[model samples]
Target: MDKKEISHSELKALIGKSPDLLLIDVRTKEEVDKGKIPGSIHMPVDSVDRDLALDPAAFQAKFGVQKPSLDAPELVFHCQMGRRGALAVEKAQALGFTKARNYAGGYKEWSEKAGK
Candidate 1:
């Protein structure tokens, strides 16, 4: 239970309820084509370090989601399992997204827990 990690149940509750929150899914294009958590913006893990450095407008145009501010409280990242998501969090924080968090259970737990 890392302080910067959110559980599936917590993420489910945050969806739609937290207007300031951004759900980021860092997975391969092919993997995401299968499915992702509803409302998640797809930004691949490899591109995170590059893309997150973009200015706000450019970031939004690229990712179709608002570029999270450096300190945005609910910038949550997830992947197939937990590892890549955690890596994404590290990248985000390195770029000053200090509050970025990992959905450590990732999509597998999310799908299973939600019976998707």
Candidate 2:
């Protein structure tokens, strides 16, 4: 199985059952001002490179979510569609977050299917 991406259904299941999962909404602030997946942390795609490098305490203060450790298994990124999310995942993986994954369907598919 490809480890670089996650399906919407898989993400939904994780939302229901995985306390450790981290859902990062990497769209622009304007796009996010409208809506995002429930419980996702809003971190725009531009800031991901800088923000993900912060120490845990600084990360929490800035993003209001605990920083995922280098190997956090359920770390996932999404955007309006999927392009930015893939880029975000690429940045994360490059920074040693090898377990980070893209939500390939993005919020379009999520909101349509999840009806939010």
Scored by lDDT, the top model is 2
lDDT of 2 by residue, 27-107 (tens): 988899888899899988889989999999999998788899998999999998899999999999899998999999999
Root-mean-square deviation of each candidate, in angstroms?
1.7, 1.4
User: Model 1 compared with the native: what TM-score?
Assistant: 0.94
- Estimate every model's Cα lDDT from 0 to 1: 0.91, 0.92
**Candidate 1: where are CA atoms >4 Å away?**
none
The TM-score obtained by model 2 is: 0.94
Candidate 1 contains a number of clashing pairs equal to: 0
lDDT, candidate 1, at 66? 84
**C-alpha lDDT (0 to 100) for residue 36 of candidate 2:** 84
Model 1: worst 10 consecutive residues (lDDT sum): 1-10
Error of 1 at 5 (Å): 0.5
lDDT of 1 by residue, 6-52 (tens): 98888888999999889999999998998899999999999999999
